[model samples]
Target: MTTKKPVVVELYDEIVFPDPSEAFLSRVQGHPAVNLPRLPAGVTLPPPIPVEDASKRRKGDTKDHSLTQWFTNFSEADELLQLAAARQRVQAHIAKLRRQISLIDGQQQQFKSTPEQ
Candidate 1:
């Protein structure tokens, strides 16, 4: 009786396998600037990052709302500025009327009251 040999398969042309060596593993660990947490005495380290894939992003699965960016453009910016200017003008006019009323009240009080002598 003879033992059977294992078969090898290539999944994709772009996918590159790492060299199963301590130097390669250490190089992969140091590739990123991140400092990985220390493992427990009996715990084993997680596998290295898979860079062979076209994109490592899992965020594409979520639905994106464009309204946030769209609304922030401030399409009615000019109209808003015009409204603000009108409000300021109205406030200034009200302040001027209040000052005139106070001045008139002061003059009327002075004329209405005569000297005791």
Candidate 2:
């Protein structure tokens, strides 16, 4: 009797991986407010801007570069956003304090203008 050979069968041959060249690149996620400008290959990064000492700055003073245009990740963006919000809150609180002082000054002037018995 002749020995019979079993035929090998292949399943899911239609499944194929996408070509690397044709593949879509995922966008780098960052802060919503930040603009992510792509730099060309071999391009050198710009020099870092010098930051001033915090102790010398006046209270509630804001710096232009406090919120940077570029960020690496979500956490960095969140941190910068929090800093901005805190700065705004400080400014608002200062304004409120100034308004209170003005009101107190006005009341003092009213007392001064009144004739004493």
Best by lDDT: 1
Please provide, for model 1 over 1-117, each residue's C-alpha lDDT reduced to its tens digit, 9 standing for 90 to 100.
446876778785544556658887688679888477786699664455566442543433222223333334433455668899999999999999999999999999998896767
Local accuracy by lDDT, each model: 0.65, 0.63
- Checking candidate 2 for backbone clashes, the offending pairs are none
Cα misplacement distance, residue 54 of candidate 2 (Å): 32
